[model samples]
Target: MRQTPDCVLDRPSVDDLDQFFSIVSDPRVWTHLPSGRLTDEEEAEAILVRLVFADRGLTAAQLGARLA
Candidate 1:
């Protein structure tokens, strides 16, 4: 895919948002956390709802090194 590289790489650009969630939220991709807790889909969905639609400007990476 092509990107203009204007928006921050760590943050979601409008175009890459759907593709990013499709990857990161996939059960097969997000396995055990470093703490060994498995992520649930409902939790992922809620997070996406908040971050993507709610216009919370914080990038997921800003949460911590783990998600980064």
Candidate 2:
């Protein structure tokens, strides 16, 4: 895990889904992301699932490529 004075960076888990969704659902957060802000809970859940799989070698980029 990496930390700075303001925040810490670490792997995300199922428990973080709500916070993750809250953050990503905001349009400001999508300024550099490939997709636009998520419009619903279902889409956020789907993205969270892919992120969890990404930690286990699937890689988010690979998942995004397939999604694209």
Candidate 3:
């Protein structure tokens, strides 16, 4: 886990959905990404689920370390 003066860098989890949604739902946050800002909570939820739980071959700890 890395900590800067302003924030900590770590793997995100399901519990972080609300905070994650708050950030990504903002239009400015998606300006450089391939897609536009998420339109609603349901959309955000689906995306987060796939990202955190889908079988991408990495174990949870491996995923967390890479993300961190």
Q: Point to the candidate with the largest TM-score.
A: 2
Tens digits of per-residue lDDT, candidate 2, 1-68, equal: 89999999998886888898898888788889838788788888888878787777887788788768
Which runs of model 2 end up more than 4 angstroms from their true locations?
Answer: 31-35, 58-68
Evaluate candidate 3 by giving its C-alpha RMSD to the native, one decimal. Answer: 7.0
Candidate with best lDDT:
2
Which ranges of candidate 3 are over 4 A from the true structure?
A: 32-35, 54-68
Q: In candidate 2, residue 48 scores what lDDT?
A: 85
Ranking, TM-score, top scorer first: 2, 3, 1
Cα lDDT, all candidates = 0.53, 0.82, 0.76
TM-score of each: 0.32, 0.63, 0.60
Write model 1 residue lDDT over 1-68, tens digit each, in one string: 34566743455444564565576656666466443333465554556555654465655565444343
For residues 1-68, could you state the per-residue lDDT of candidate 3 as single tens digits? 79999999976767879988998798788778837688789888767755776545666677667757
**Model 2 clashing-pair count:** 0
